[model samples]
Target chain A: MSARPQVDPRGPRFAAWVTSAVLVAVLLTGWWPLLAAQVVVFAVGAFASLSAAPYSVLYRVLVAPRLGPTDEREDVAPLRFAQGVGFAFALVGTLGYAFGVPALGVVATAFALAAAFLNAAFGLCLGCETYLLLHRLPGSTRTVSDH
Target chain B: MTGALVALGTLLVAAVVGFALRARDGRVRAREDDTAARVPAEVRAALDAGARVTLVQLSTTFCAPCRQTRVLLSDLAARTDGLAHADVDLTDRPELAKALSVLRTPTTLAVDSRGVELLRVGGVPKRENLLAALAPHLPG
Candidate 1:
């Protein structure tokens, strides 16, 4: 409802790269702890300030300084929404791995990895797209102005 | 190991989807059926006076690529005569989106002064492709 902060557009992409890596680890190892850690990472980005998220912090500290400063900035709301989407997937993955449902774990992690990989490699934010589409669905009460 | 194979398969599947999306994004398509559809008053009001054609972009608050598309469409409009760019935010107006049958943000509808729909582009448009598509409708 309030004015959201703007961030360097590349920051989210960088975070997506890390997310892809983490998700790939989850898929390869089928490790519940690793997936749980990724869920926590997604939680921080979704529920807290996106700029303060772990991967964004790393980008700000290490990656951003090496690149020239860019005037183009992006709103944080969509990226935060995307993190929430990722959190849901990662949480499902963690539960699946922990509860002897390896198939669910693999499928969920693969889906998350697919999304993160798209963002990292091609700048396509599937979660953001999903948010927009959901907003356009019939009987939706949410509005762009309130976002 | 099967785990490595599964991971590799996941990466391959992601790559294929990414490529497919890349191929489809920003490609303009003709919509002759929408010729009968009238542009909304809000969209018409956003058009430049005396404009022959307007690129009406539907946008949302959190759409990142919409920002990039705005820059591209605005710059293109400024450089061309009788062409105008207007962006309508649909975040608060889901009914408008539904009425327009817009499935995504950054969907640009090219309409004439009479509010007749011309062409539409989903996602960010390819510059050369958009220019080529609009050439016949534009005055030299």
Candidate 2:
């Protein structure tokens, strides 16, 4: 109800695009390192700023400048929660590849890829939905906004 | 061989899921039409205020499409007599969000004057579809 904190809606989508590309590489090579890099990207976006969240820095400097700043800023918390969801998937996917679990790695990356692609292509946030599900979990603090 | 197949298969699966989510965007589905449990009166009353019908919007502060949902529903409320718009932020009110079974941002609940639930829209609702949803609820 208070004045909503604002962020460019493009930031997350830009980050998703990069995550999707890295995940595709992860699937093709089953390479733990690429997945590791992606896990770090998700962590940065989850807990920190876009400046550190891969490709978002480019968007902030180049794309945001050319866009001339329309009034499309969004609330920041959901985007951060969304990034956390991405991080969980990336972390699990990296572990699967690291442990030689080919099927598990592929499955995790595929699921994460679907989510990232949905955000990048359709502007739908799968992580936001995951955030909602977390709130529904029993007997915990029901607030996701505080975190 | 398996990696190539999974790579191809993964792309195909991604495409299918993407299309499906996009298909459901901004469309209203009346739960009444679907035979779900009736929306409780206290909940409906919280949303309804001196109107023939109320468009209750469930939103979170950071939801992008919720903004679009607010603008459209408020415009509909203005155009229709005895129809009012109510917006609730679920960020701090997750219990209400859970009780309402809201899975996505900008989820909307349509409640009639008698407090019977009419429709529930899961995402951003298109104007045309919203008008049609209201048609049956509108006064003769």
Best by DockQ: 1
Error of 2 at A139 (Å): 10
Q: In lDDT terms, how accurate is model 1?
A: 0.83
Q: What's the DockQ of model 1? A: 0.60
The recovered share of true contacts, given per candidate in order, is 0.58, 0.41
**What's model 1's interface RMSD, roughly to a tenth of an angstrom?**
2.0
Q: What ranges in model 2 sit over 4 Å off?
A: A66-68, A137-146, B33-38, B91-101
Candidate 1 deviant stretches above 4 angstroms: A1-4, A136-147, B32-35, B40-45
Worst 10 residues of 1 chain A by lDDT: A138-147
lDDT measured at residue A29 in model 1 versus the true structure, 0 to 100 = 79
lDDT of 2 by residue, B48-83 (tens): 657878888887755767777788889988988878
What TM-score would you report for chain A in candidate 2? Answer: 0.84
